[model samples]
Target: MEKNDKFPTRKDMTYWIIILILFMVGSFTVYYGSNKDMVSHIGFGGTIVSILLAVIAIIYSFYQSSTYESTTYKLDTSAQKIEEATKQLSDVSEIKTVLESFKGEVKEINESIIDLKGISNNIGNGVNSMKESFENTKTTFFESFNPISPKHVEVDEIDFSTNYFIKMLDNGGNFPLFTLALANQAHINKISKVNLRQYNKIYMKFLMGGKQADLGKDIHEAFRNIQFGMLSAYKSSRFVDIDFVEDDFIQINDINENLSQAIVHKVESLNDEQDGDKPLYDFLLTMKNKLSWDEE
Candidate 1:
């Protein structure tokens, strides 16, 4: 038979029955027995049995109290868990409501996107038409607007221009010196570099050349002369500018002239320093004299 978990088991009931029967036997012995000592012993045994019963009752009451406390704790824990679950469900419901509102806003955005896609398709078609028109005009646009494209200079034009420029530099109003005075220094430098390096080389080759001939120092001399002239012109141009600006050229010139004179005198004083060894001085002073012009 399965053991019942009910408060009193069969074994406990049997123990209680045995104890009560002993108590009854002792009571009867005390009441009716003729021997005085036997009666007194039975009386004392009954008292002890009664005390065991009282102790058992007290133990049972304590067990019941502990069981009640345990059940109450379990109930309290279940109630707290249930309250937390209810709070979580309320939060989930609030989140669902927010999501429902967001769904309507997303639907509106999707509708706007669909309309925008249609408008964009029309814009794309218009752009395609404009792209074709631009493609047709592309070559002319670059030819007009592009600054990097090389100019179309004829061979004869180059020849005539070179001769005329040299003649003007030699005889006519000194065009380059006048240009240096009028134009910005940076602009003048740019023009000089292009002409001296590229056009001058071409002009020299055209004027005198076997296919493989070297026009050695002719181009070099021209380049140096251009440099010196530019410097001299720039110096003179500064004077003209200061004069126009009502600044005394001589006052400004005096400081620069003194500085220049000091540098020259320093170099000259080195002559005295190197009096014993002229070659060392001479080596340092290579190309010290002004270079003669081609006409000279």
Candidate 2:
């Protein structure tokens, strides 16, 4: 749009032209007749010209006013359109901002998904590694002490380890194995010093899985023969009932079996390639599973 001052009004020009025509009409009047009855008039051409001049001036004024009003209405309409266009632009900008924010949120979500996938892959790899390790170590684990693989007895009649072991099983005065079991650690260490390693390997293999929870007063009567050395000291010991039920020994036996199995597995794994512990490993371990002393 051009400046507001540039619009044409034509009011001043119309007024001046009307005034000029009126002056010319006044100056052209003709007078005739006696003084008392005299009248003033303009000739026909002058009268016609004057009326036509006045009509033209009025028509020009009406046309100018109409044109000016039309221009003002058009300018007002244009201004309204410009204001609407500006508002639309602002709305579009706001929409663009909202879309940009949504896009950013979507990007963040995708990144989070990517991170989760990476974590999932790492977890998968770790699980696979653990599975492979377990597979590699599976054979070293033991089953029941009944022996899955039969091993040869290493000791013949002259084997020193065997003779020494038989001596440990012997308790003084015919109560043999029972007395040796409760001997102090020092006596046991001294007696087995010559072939201690072989004896220990033998003992551990047999008793590996046969450990029992201390039932304290619970199993006293069943194995009270174990306290025979000190039984004479307690005057009431002889009078105590020695009776036992089958169930009382069941739990102790089961625990021993589980421990023995675990020990076998560990030993087998350690000596898998060496084969040093193979000879009496199974025989002693299975023999120790005989929990009932009276059954023999």
Candidate 3:
């Protein structure tokens, strides 16, 4: 029932000791009876018996001491092992705590990173919204000035589509006039006039809303400005001039081809004839001279 009663105790050693002494006595009786003559030598027998007892006692004492030492060594070794095991357990506990702390920190960092990513996404969305609004504003601006063109636009870079639009605008709302102006040099002097007339005609038709509703007085002002600008440009010194025999003009049906060559020749001749003291050069020289005088 009780733990101590269940198992034997050190009190059981008394019974073992009594049994060992009884066994020793029995063994001595048998040995002495078997050696009666040995026992008859009185002094020698006593001496021999005493020596044998003393040797047995010494051997037993040595055996007991060795056994006690071995037992003590086993107990000490077990205690040391237990102490080391306890220290190892404590170290394992500390390591586990540190690992748990690291895990919590990592979790928090992961959460923070997720929040940052969400904030980035929100910022991206805001930027996209702003971009959309700006695009809508641009479209609205273009639509507002649909019929009439603007004078100038400022941009960081120029692209082909924008250049084309600028060319169209410069040509007084006549897209065809821009095309005609870039034609071969022959036509630039001769047929360019006819092409320019054609460009005006096209522009007029387009202004009348291209066979749809008549734009009427709405585009009248713009048309007037375009006609004035075009006429002014046509009469200006910028337009090419040709002087050829009347017969030659009648002979060539292809005005552009011949006039292109003539224009190239005229350009080369003008370059060659150019003097440093020409009025245009003199005007530029006058500006430089004024600048120098001012500096002085």
Candidate 4:
């Protein structure tokens, strides 16, 4: 009812009918006038040949249609495969992009770790330096308060008379007549007990108070002259009496005690005043402590 679009139109059908009628009439006339005689000569063989050619033309048309259909199907399948391969390539590219991003992140994290390690090393070094400084400060602080111990020497090896005699001569003191008498060993041996007692009394007094600065210069010089004479006499006599010289004078304990008492008196006199001799006083106290002298 919709005019059946696949069929030929009325005008085309009418045209084709007229052309068919004309072809049939023309063909009949040509066959009757010319081919009728020829057909009588050739008989049915010519008619059979025409029918075989028509059958071959129909078979060739069918083969061409089938080949066209197969080629179209193959082309469609190839296009589908190409589309799928393109999609897979796109997915691989995306994966590569993700991996590159991840690698960059990992590199950043490694760099941060290295930076942290450097900071940690710096902090460790600072702490160690602080500890060393503290230890040095502590050592210096303790040493400031602690006193150093002194070295002791043997007293018996020292020649007290000779040492005193040299100090006296160096001070420009004069020798006495008793020293000249004692220079002769025979006169020294012949010295009487009464004379020895008087000599001992004078020498003991000189040793006890001779070195005092409070004594007048004349008295000090007189005491030094007498000390020089007495020391020269003792040395020339060659007396090895430890009590007379070495133990009484040159022993560190006896000398430290005597010097300590003198320093104490000097320090007391400088109380509430400028202490010019404070260093000397401290030195004597240290020496006395080292000698283990009893404090007076």
Candidates in order, TM-scores: namely: 0.32, 0.31, 0.32, 0.28
Which residue ranges in model 2 land beyond 4 Å of their true spot? 1-50, 133-296
Top lDDT prediction, candidate number = 3
Candidate lDDT scores, in order, read: 0.44, 0.40, 0.46, 0.43
What is candidate 3's lDDT per residue for 1-296, written digit by digit as tens? 65676435577878888899999989877878678675677668789899999999999999999999999999999999999999999999999999999999999999999987876676555445534533453344344234454533333333424343333333222222222222332243333123223233333333332322222342333433433433333324233232222311211123233324433332233233442223322332333343344334
For 1-296, candidate 2 gives per-residue lDDT tens digits of 87556534587678888999987767644333333333333355678889999999999999999999999999999999999999999999999999999999999999999987876676455445533533332222111111443322233435434333332222111111222221222122232212222223333333323322222342233233323322222113221111222322211111122222333343343335573344344443333333122123
112-171 per-residue lDDT for model 4 (tens digits): 999878766765554455345434433442332234512121134344343433332222
Q: What residue pairs are clashing in model 1?
A: none
Query: Model 4: clashing residue pairs?
Result: none
Consecutive 10-residue window with the lowest summed lDDT within model 2 = 247-256
Candidate 2 lDDT for residue 129: 50
Off by over 4 Å in 4: 1-54, 126-296
Q: Which lDDT value does model 2 have at 295?
A: 27
Question: What CA RMSD would candidate 1 show?
Answer: 25.0
Candidate 2 global CA lDDT score: 0.40
Top candidate (TM-score): 3
Q: Candidate 2: give the clashing pairs.
A: 171-176, 208-260, 209-256, 209-259, 209-260, 210-256
